[model samples]
Structure formats: structure tokens, C-alpha cells
Target: MPTKKLGVYPELLTSIEKARQLIIPEDRIRVLNPLIEYIQSKIDQGQEINLNFICTHNSRRSQFSQIWAQTAADYFGIPANCYSGGVEITAFNERAVASIKRSGFKVSAKGDANPVYYVFHSDDKEAITAFSKLFNDPINKGSQFAAVITCSHADENCPFIPGTEKRIPVRYEDPKEFDNTSEESAKYDERSLQIASEMFYVFSNVKMPA
Candidate 1:
């Protein structure tokens, strides 16, 4: 599929492209290559690619990873599913949601406890459904999914994810550190962009079928 087929929002396209330029340190790509290889192997076998990003709170970084990874898959014309969860359920932080909105996504929320959000990167593309839930939530695949631990705490605490084929610890710094401080928005957007950059890199590196 041609890149044009993605039809992502113009603003988001700009952001993703910019994020791509920001990915640095050749070692980071080396670190992420395993994940790229795993997804590629699944695609080569014509298997469904399911990624479950987990964090302790399921609030910020994990949510961004899910959204960006799914978007990157779509942008690359790869058939994959992305989901996010935590060890314990907590609402997707409003601050993180705000940062994504600033990044050009359209977000609509419903309910309170673990409210579901329909996040759209473009008016033409289907929205990504996001919320807080357990890693094994019924909405997520029960087996054969890669468990991507996005925080050190979750990775250390949940040593064994029951049925995951691969467990990748691709940790990120918590933007929560800056919460209620003057740097809140900037740091949140910074973290979101960093994840977005890495996700784009992963999908961009995949050897999609011709």
C-alpha cells in the first residue's frame, strides 16, 4: 500500500514526520530492533500482530504507546492491533489526554470509571478506542500478544505475563514528575512525541510485504 493510502490528518502527518527526525542515538534503534523484528516475523507468517502496552497506572506513557503504535501500523499499511492496560485500573490521565489533543488528535470521552475514549488522528481514519483496564481485560487478546512494559515498575513487578509470546521492556521516563509544575504540558508532549517517534521508527523499519 502506498503511504498516501493512510490518509492521516495533515497535522498528525507533520507531527509523525517531525518525530521521525528527532529519534537519535543509533543505539536506541538497536534497542528497538527486537520489537521491529518480532512484528515483522508475525507479518511474514501472516499472523495477527497484537501489542499490549502496560504500565503501573495505565494513564500516560502506555496510552501514548498504544495510540502511536496503532497509528504507525496504519500509516505503514500493516494489519496490527494495539491495546493498553495497567496492573491496576486508573482513569487515563486528563493531562496526558490534553497533550495528545495538542498533538492534533480528536478525543471524545464517555463514562467515568475507566472511561472509554474515541481518539481520532484524522477525520477520515477510524478512531482508536482507549481506556484504562487490566492487562488481561476481555477486550484484549488473551494469548499470543506481545507484552510491552513501558515503565520500570510494571516490568519489575509483573515478571511473567501469563501467555505473552514476547515481553519487551521499552521503558520511558514518567512525565508525572512534572505534573502540577510549570513544565507539565511541555513534558507531557515531550514524552508523547518520544513514544511517537519510536513507534514510527518501528513501523518504518518493518519489511512490509510487497
Candidate 2:
């Protein structure tokens, strides 16, 4: 287990430190295995795996997936690239950003109406750059990337994603419903932890090269 380092908030560090305790159910693991296999296959081929998590608005779940996946990849020492986009351009919601912050990340936002947020999970790790854009945004990998659909709406709507080698539907419940409610903070944190736990499960299970 990694110990807390400087620049990481104490509360957020605690949240991340406890993440390993949340066990993902066996049934959910079945759904996640394909993603694991996909990453492993890419590594076997001496190729870099790029995952783009997509949603209808590029707001909550998609952002969480991208952040967690990247964090997990780094933690597991897997050479994988992670990105997030949507069917339509919309700002990465503040609620999602707040949730990630509570998980021990240092965040800084720039711009508005489509702000770009720099989310740092640790001082030594590269910061994740987040914003809203189309699925094929210029900032993302153009081809040979897996399109991970984070929301059911995006999956059903964008059936054919151009240039993607694989399309994996790993849907998650939207925490947007609890927006502005009393459970906002709790629900958002819950969703973040869920994504983080699953991502940890995925990368942790990967067989490192011999």
C-alpha cells in the first residue's frame, strides 16, 4: 500500500487508501473482464491501449471512468491511455469534479462553459486533463482506441464509433439524479468509489510482463 505523500489532502487520501476494501461482486467482474483482456492483448502486441469513456453529456460517469481508469493504469504500472468525451459537448459538471476531489485529488479548473480541469491524483503522477468535447475530439487518440460507453444513452445512440478498434459497453448508474439533493455529496462519492474500485480490480488483475 502506498503511503500518503505531500500535496494530497488528508481526507481524500483516506478515501483512496480505503478503496481496496470495497469488493466488486463476481457478476460485475464478468462484465469487466473484456476490458481487462483487451488491455492485455494490446500489451502483448506491443501496442498502447487507449480507452475513451463516452456518455451523452460527458458530465459525470464518463469523467469518473476516465479518471479512475487512468489512475488505476498508473497504479498498476500498465501503459494505457485514458480519455472521456460525449455525443454532445457539455462542460464536465462541477459535481463530478467535487466528487473526485473528495477522493484525494488536487484539482484546478480553467475556462467556463466547457472548462478544462486539471485533476491530480498524486504529486508524482501526471495530471488528468478533463473537459467536454465530441467523442472524436482532436485531443484524443484518433484510432485504435477502445470506445468505452459509460452511459446507456450514449451506447444506444452512437452504435458506430469511427476508428475505434473495440467498443466496450461498461455502463454505470448516473449520479446526476442526486444533483442538488441532500444526498449529493454522498451519492457522488459513492459513484466515484464504485468506479475506482472496479478500475482497481481491472488493473490489479492484469498479468505483468515476465
Best by TM-score: 1
Each prediction's TM-score against the native?
0.96, 0.93
- By summed lDDT, the worst window of 10 consecutive residues in model 2 runs over 1-10
Record all residue pairs in model 2 with backbone atoms less than 3 Å apart, i.e. clashing: 12-104
List, residue by residue over 1-210, the lDDT tens digit for candidate 2: 322233445765577567778988888899899999999899888998899999999989999999988887776678889999999998999898888887888899899778899988777777899998898999999899999998999999899999999999899999989989999999999999999888888888877677
Instruction: Residues 1-210, candidate 1: write the lDDT tens digits.
Output: 335476677777778877888946787777788899899999999999999999998999999999999888888877889998899998899999999888888899999877899999776578898998899999888899999999999999999888799998899999999999999999999999999999988988888777
lDDT score, residue 83, model 1? Answer: 90
List per-candidate RMSD values in Å.
1.4, 2.3
User: Where does candidate 1 stray beyond 4 Å?
Assistant: 1-4
Model 1 / residue 119 / CA error / Å: 0.5
- TM-score of predicted structure 2: 0.93
Number of the top-ranking candidate, with lDDT as the measure: 1
lDDT per model vs. reference: 0.89, 0.86
In candidate 2, residue 192 scores what lDDT? 90
